[model samples]
Target: MKHPKVINLVQEPEVFYRIQNKYDRIISVLGGSMQVGQVVNSDIDLIDITRRGLPKSVVITVSLILGISMEKMSSLLHVSHRTIQRKGDDELLNVYSTEQILEIAEVISRGIEVLGTLENFTKWLHSDVRALNYSKPLDYLDTSFGTKLVKDILGRIEHGVYS
Candidate 1:
């Protein structure tokens, strides 16, 4: 007889949060406004759009929201600064970059909500966090693993865990 494999739900936050966010809100944050016919109802809808790649304008918008420079944003995305600067805002990035940008956007959205204000969250992102070995949260934006760490920290901050 064969048995089914078991997986830990806590280890799969991406799947867990699939329906927790309104993709429309993320689109609104990235696009700056809700455009007609651009509604996103679930992860499936978002994945369809993201697989086609997102506009360069999104990186620009998220950079401004995080209070960082294009150079810093490029570093976080593991994209060269020149590459980003060479492209026009309306241009599309490769799917890999688009996915990374989306992850960062989710962090920012969650951070702002949990930390109260955008300014506070922006400050927190740049400042060294003691719980993170005195490292700035910006240091972890480069990889999905690190991004998850930042999100976990945000959750702790929200619950007043003081870490």
Candidate 2:
């Protein structure tokens, strides 16, 4: 069997620490393995982490990963800013929000795989692309349909297409 790719968090301390904090917050609410700074073997690991429901801190982490603001994240999740705030750290997101978070995580993992770095992927997401009708890929992340469009573009880019 082929071994899964391992992302060594120790090598990327900043991103590692950010994810560590998020993991800590998640475990605080949902209770899970408390190990920190471990490798993300695959997208499956991420999906497993949120199998129940994600903590609100995940929104902050995703915001950091995508370089978007909390307000934009609220828009993407189709929730009000105050609603997000009211949920607090211990509250779990609804099923739809959890699914969206998982989908975004999958995209983030794939983007990193294709672009070779999180910074490169974030730049690609924020840049306007002709294939996407000259709109920044980040703009399409506000809804499920838009997320699918961004994922399709990422798939094309992965396959060496000029998307």
Q: Give one digit per residue, the lDDT tens place, for model 1 in 30-79.
A: 65323212456568866866787778877887787777899998998889
Model 2 pairs in collision: none
Candidate 2 has its poorest 10 consecutive residues by lDDT at 28-37
Q: Candidate 1: where is the Cα deviation over 4 Å?
A: 1-21, 33-37
Candidate 2 C-alpha lDDT tens digits along 1-163: 5533233332342343234233322222222233312233455655655566677866776777778888898988889988998887757787678778766755666666577777788899989998888999888876678778888888898899997
**TM-score on alpha carbons, each prediction:** 0.81, 0.71
The CA lDDT of each predicted structure is 0.72, 0.65
Measured with C-alpha atoms, the lDDT of residue 65 in candidate 2 is 73
Clashing pairs in 1: none
